[model samples]
Target chain A: MTIREIGDLLDARVLCGKDLDVDVKSACGSDMMSDVLAFVKHRAALLTGLVNPQVIRTAEMMDMLCVVFVRDKTPTIDMIELAEESGIAVLATSKRMYEACGILYANGLKGNGELHG
Target chain B: MGESLAFHYEVDGGDFTSAGQASVKIKKNLRQLGVDAETIRRVSIAMYEGEINMVIHANGGNADVIVDDTGVTIILADKGPGIADTEKAMEEGYSTAPDNVRSLGFGAGMGLPNMKRYTDDMKIESVLGEGTTITMKVNF
Candidate 1:
């Protein structure tokens, strides 16, 4: 799915990088940034309820195309600016984490599979 | 490759909000310096994890990124309480962070592991009470 589609599916508001129109194959939902770094692969949009600069940094380090904040969490101006600087799209949604993940999964965004050493 | 390009950042402890700023700056610098995206990503992730560890465990620290023809090295130094056991710290699920740190989406015991996973070379130096320094390298 594209960034645009994911935003629409989640009914999320684009907080930054609204110009981005990239396609993301998979999505991962987690509040833990470490888990995302250690295990996630081939996922583009990070579905998270956690709001912090590290969330944006994690997506940037992993080369993720977008970060979607779930459950109506408010991102500070710092976060929006950082996402803009990193060229990462940011979306905020009222959907809960599980519901957002389900919507994306039902819409055909699946994890690429396990990552091995 | 006439000289090594070096970047220095002093991580401020007690400021959880400012964590990862150095990594972000280094990532941008490397990008503009013409480093490949993949190598930049690896270095960024490695250094980011280090920065998080420094803030969460050490209260704050220093991070340096040195770049040369063959590789990039990140040196993180902190005077916080040193690791009691290197072997246990290296484990995938071993962490000593407090509950507050966990609520912030970190302290999952994957910081060190993630640092090692994304880099080509990694070494940790610690003195039970003195401090800890982590050095990581990612080769082109």
Candidate 2:
């Protein structure tokens, strides 16, 4: 799905990179930045409830096209600016983590898949 | 473009919010040099984890990124209290970070392991009373 479509489905507000139309095929939801760093692969959207500059930094490092904040959490001005600087689309949704992941998954966006040993 | 290029930055342990600035800069630098995306991601993630560890534990330190034909090398040095047990520390799910850090979405005890997971090679040198230095490499 396109990033714009994901936002539409999630009823999210586009905070930055509003024009980005990157395609997102997979996503991972977690409050732990380390897990995201350890597991996520390929270019995908990151669904996280955690709010910190590191969140944006994590997305940027993974070359993620977008970061969707679950549960209506507001990102700090620093985060918005960093996302803008990194050219990553930022979205905020009132939907909780599970619901958000489910919504995206039900609509064709799926997880990166099982971890390998 | 050069055979070997080095970038250095001083991490400010005073602020948790600003911990990964050096890693961000390194990511941008590698991108500008036309490094491959996967390699860039590996190097930056490992370095970013190291940067966070330094701030959360050592109160700040120095980070250096050296890029060459074979790979990228990251050297992180800090003067914080050294890890008591390297073996245990390297194990996943082992952490000494305070509770407040976890509230900020870190201190998951995955920092060192994640660093090793993403990099091609990792070495840690620490003097309990003195400090610690970690060197990680990622091939291009």
| DockQ for all candidate structures vs. native | 0.72, 0.69
Candidate 1: global Cα-lDDT?
A: 0.87
- Best-fitting candidate, measured by DockQ? 1
Q: What tens-digit string does per-residue lDDT give for candidate 1 at A11-101?
A: 8898888565688977788999998887546647898999888898888888888999999998999899988987899999999999999
C-alpha lDDT (0 to 100) for residue B123 of candidate 1: 93
Among all candidates shown, the one with the greatest TM-score? 2
Point out where model 1 deviates above 4 Å. Answer: A40-43, A113-117
**Residue-wise lDDT of candidate 2 within B29-115, one digit each (tens)?**
999999998788888889999999999999999999999989999999999999889999999888899999988878999999989
Top of the candidates by lDDT? 2
Local accuracy of candidate 1 as per-residue lDDT tens digits, B77-127: 999899999989989989999999888899989989888888888999999
Per-residue CA lDDT of candidate 2, range A1-117, in tens?
Answer: 898999999999999985657777678998988888887566688999899998998888888889999998999998999999998999999999999999999998878743312
Worst 10 residues of 1 chain B by lDDT: B12-21
Roughly what TM-score does model 1 have, to 2 decimal places? Answer: 0.94
